[model samples]
Target chain A: MSTTTATSGRARRPKKPITLVGVDVYVITEDGIPKFDEYGPFKIEFISNRGTKVWPGYVSPDLMLVNWYRCRFNATRPVTDKDVDAFVGELGKKHQWSAVQKLWNYGDEAGFSKAY
Target chain B: MAKHVITMLPGEGTGPEICEAVRAVIDHTGVDITWEYEDIGLDCLKEHGTLLPEKTIKSIAKNKIAIKGPTTTPIGTGHKSANVTLRKMFDLYANVRPAKLIPVLKRPWDKIDILSFRENTEDSYAAIEHMVSDEVAQCLKVITWPGSVRIAEFAFKWAKANGRKKIQCVHKANIMKMTDGLFLEAFREVAKKYPEMESGDIIVDNCSMQLVRNPGQFDCLVLPNLYGDILSDLCAGLVGGLGFAPGANIGDNCAIFEAVHGSAPKYAGMKKVNPSAVLLSGVMMLKWLGETKAAERIEKGVDKVLAEGKHLTYDAGGTASTDEYAQAIIRAMDTL
Candidate 1:
């Protein structure tokens, strides 16, 4: 018993940290405009439809509420995927997401967040 | 030749009484076993001031096998359970409880036989609970990959050795994706190695329903600790109750056989409580020791006595005392 020490036989490596640049989600609505109700107060700059900016007030009575909206949210600091997931998940509790696109910054500084 | 040395913990309450009856039946089988008694549980608490004495643990460690009577864990006393302590000390990870139908007792169905493989030593049974707030308390449910794999391997090896045709991996993988998912995943990996045996899985809730509705369909069931604790008792109800249930805790180095039923302190010294459970546990001990002939003899004797319906304890609906019921088993052993 004295000879045995409390340690693992194998050498273990620590986990690497994750860097999250921003989070993007496509939220759908039932009866209202996506920008007014779904994308609550974040630095969401440009709303797009197949690569076209249909933002600021895209709500029109003639346009049917097909209920699909995609907005990109920028984080103040680099965050992990877990951080982005928590943000998106809390939003999901009230609003439904037809689809979610997470935009990551792998340190290339390609400026995908600045493209819009 | 020297007899096979086996450790015995007489336990508390009816544990000692029923154990004496079981010892008598084992004696009649004519197999030589030198009993090494150890004071544990309540008896040890009285003398040594601890529920599980160090000597008791050392004895079982040295002997490698033991048949124990049911020990009482005084509730709300803040002391850790002697059973849990012993299991953790030895890393006794696999808890095996067999629920076999007895012809004497009436049931919803007949010929129902099930051997449950419970992953001991983990799950909420680890007892890592904390007060989240004044109104709320929470317990951590822990699951590990190696714990799952070893129990799965143990279950499959038991199935292969015992000639069982199918094994059911019971879990709630849909809800507890991480914990039960790992459990089911390990079971699937181990099942692939046994080509001859049929392997499948069922969710815990649906598995409980299937057990009561159609218990005979299940051959061997493997599950995590919590679900196993619940479902094993449910299976026991299918074929009478705990009196007919026998349990075994299997580890790499040591194994302990025990009656899954409680030690009825109220019925202590009355000689009225049924001894079949512990006696059957002794049958399990004999088999574990490789005394297959003696094991079979005692099993048959128990069956014959129960089938005759002449000498059963009050729980089984007869007028016989605990010792008398044991004597009836012994009397029938002559034919075996």
Candidate 2:
């Protein structure tokens, strides 16, 4: 009868290390691709146009605008939110990107091998 | 002994031309002011890698008082505004702009005299913007309780000191609940202590309408960063254009007085611009320095020149060169 206990009261578990981050930035362009550049330490895995991956990779050209771009970067080491924020902050200034979002890669690896 | 060691920046383009006008008035004051000139804006940027050099910061820190010309801020996205940089550097949290009819300038509202206090440091002026997605970009509007309280306190204290009867807080709290809410909340708290002055809050849009409809009803107004930025300019238009508006960026340590107008690069050497804004700013600087006599003297001289209506810039509806208008003010001081 007491076997089923409430899990809602349990403390939140710690988040896994950030292995990857997806930053969404707004720059005004119709093509939606940032000029490819070495990000230093972190490698730019791919860039996406709207929702479709467009760089280091390709999606249908019909679905891309040059102004908005989502750049995904791969980090060898697990990154903290602070690290991601600071990294994005620097990148934002350099490229004058209007927005940035950090996406984490954890749990299991999926797409890279299949895409490669 | 010199009353104050003030830093004077001639700035870029027409800046130098108008600054000379202020210099003439300063000389007539007989305040024995020691002037330390500094280079800033486009000229300094070209010579140095940065728009705001370390030397300029150090000079303001040392002098604690500066009177400057309008530096050119590039339109669109280029170098960040030097004025914004200086404001952040010194933590100049209060931007005070007083707009009043000068009798010389022909305007609809002759009785419009509004003293506006704008919170300078926080809100969108922080410039912390980032793109959340390529399609969605966001600039963070930070409104802290301390920032709000300090600005409100400054407004109330200023109102009490200046004998201003009513103080109005301008905000868009209904739309921006949290940020603008914090601002209005703090303003109300600060307004409580100043029982002598009547205080109220007006939604920014309505305040704009009221300003245009009946500007005489407003005695003093306090606003958050972006609203203040737009409203101050609108208030400036009530009396005259930016050419007639003088601004003071003040903090605990330093105060910078300057014309709120832009540097008209096309008319750099033409000397056909109004120097009233910069000269009035000098009057403000003198007032801040406790050299009230000198301040009043300069203001009266300016009043005389404006009343004479003979030697004025084309912008002010006359045909006097920049130097000629300044000479007129100085000559008026001689009579004072």
Candidate 3:
């Protein structure tokens, strides 16, 4: 499909209410903690809670942000594919974390190595 | 009729007929024209040594406004770029181009109306332009806090004044920080003021892809210098062509609106040229003059003439020559 059709498709999809409590999502071992926080090279900031809520229209409400860091983070290298997989894996294996009513896990933006 | 001097730097390879068209405006308006005319030819490369002369620079600085037909920037040439020099010297921070669906001309998308307020100075357009090395020549991308804040502030103000609904700050800060990052940060700060308008920050790459795909979703795009230049041209294409796209170079004390397209040398001297870009730029100039009523009349005339969809040059999908199109617009003005 055209990029328009795809982006419009993405824009219109209904999103479930989800929040990334920065505390849990950034646990050191599950996903590498962002340590080089020397305010980064510049003040790249997350201005709003813009992406945490996914709008996955007719399909199931996507709890996971399609672009994982869409939850908001600031850095130089950009949030990578490996980062997404780690977040999904960490949430999937623990205390029914991935299936929380307020949030659910879609495929990690990184890749499709099945968690089941 | 308030008289204002608009300097035209046709330089070399400028066609004869285009000169007459510009002269016609001066004669018709009966305005004193301060012709900042100079033969900034190849010799200019050897002497005071620039494609754009210090004389033209002083004229723009003194008048605070000017217009031009076209200027050729020879690629890989030793001479510095005239346009880049003026844009930087005057600190003309914001390059504002309005892309409206002209009354006729049958556009592909109705929902597309975008005003691009591109950062004019820094970024790759800084003309810090040099060959970094034999294998890897480079242009620096320097995005600053003040640069970003100024452009973002202008975009929001522009949106507020024009009744636009949304604003999008396009950048590639995801990878290139320090420069693009500063712009993004300023957007965050300034955006807080205009809560009325919905806002989103898009990666410059995604914005480029989407603009061609769905020009509809966008309204106002504020970006760094290079992205603005590229995107504004794309917007010009959507409405009709660069011929219909009017642009304004604005700073704190001054504003210069002009024909955004280049001076097409091959088509020079042949009255078969399109003056839509220059005339539309004139309309913008009037608006800048605070003569909104005259600007409205000019715009309405332009709309009616084009809506009739006849008397258009090659670009506007009609057989009419340049003068014929201008005549139609003048007629539209009289009827109004």
Best TM-score goes to which candidate? 2
User: Model 2: how far is A19 from its true place, Å?
Assistant: 15
lDDT of 1 by residue, B1-336 (tens): 437788998898898889899999998888898888998787788899998777877788778889899888768434667887666556678999999999999887967999999998677665543333223345556676778888999999998899999999999999999999999999999998998999999999999998988998999999999999999999888989998888899888888899888889899999998988888888888898889999999899999999999999898899899999999998898877
Q: Looking at candidate 2, what is the lDDT of residue B126? A: 57
The candidate, 1 or 2, that scores higher on TM-score is 2
DockQ of each: 0.01, 0.03, 0.01
- Per-model CA lDDT versus the true structure: 0.78, 0.78, 0.62
Quick one: ranking by TM-score, best first? 2, 1, 3
Candidate 3 regions with alpha-carbon error over 4 angstroms:
A1-116, B1-3, B10-16, B19-50, B129-133
For B291-332, candidate 3 gives per-residue lDDT tens digits of 567667767877887778777788777888777777776677
Where does candidate 1 stray beyond 4 Å? A1-116
TM-score for all predictions?
0.74, 0.77, 0.68
Question: Candidate 1's error at A96, in angstroms?
Answer: 38
Model 2 over residues B70-126: C-alpha lDDT tens digits? 888888556778887677556678999999977877777759989999988778775
Off by over 4 Å in 2: A1-116
lDDT of 3 at B132: 22
Clashing pairs in 3: A13-A55, A13-A56, A13-A57, A14-A55, A14-A56, A14-A57, A15-A54, A15-A55, A15-A56, B70-B263
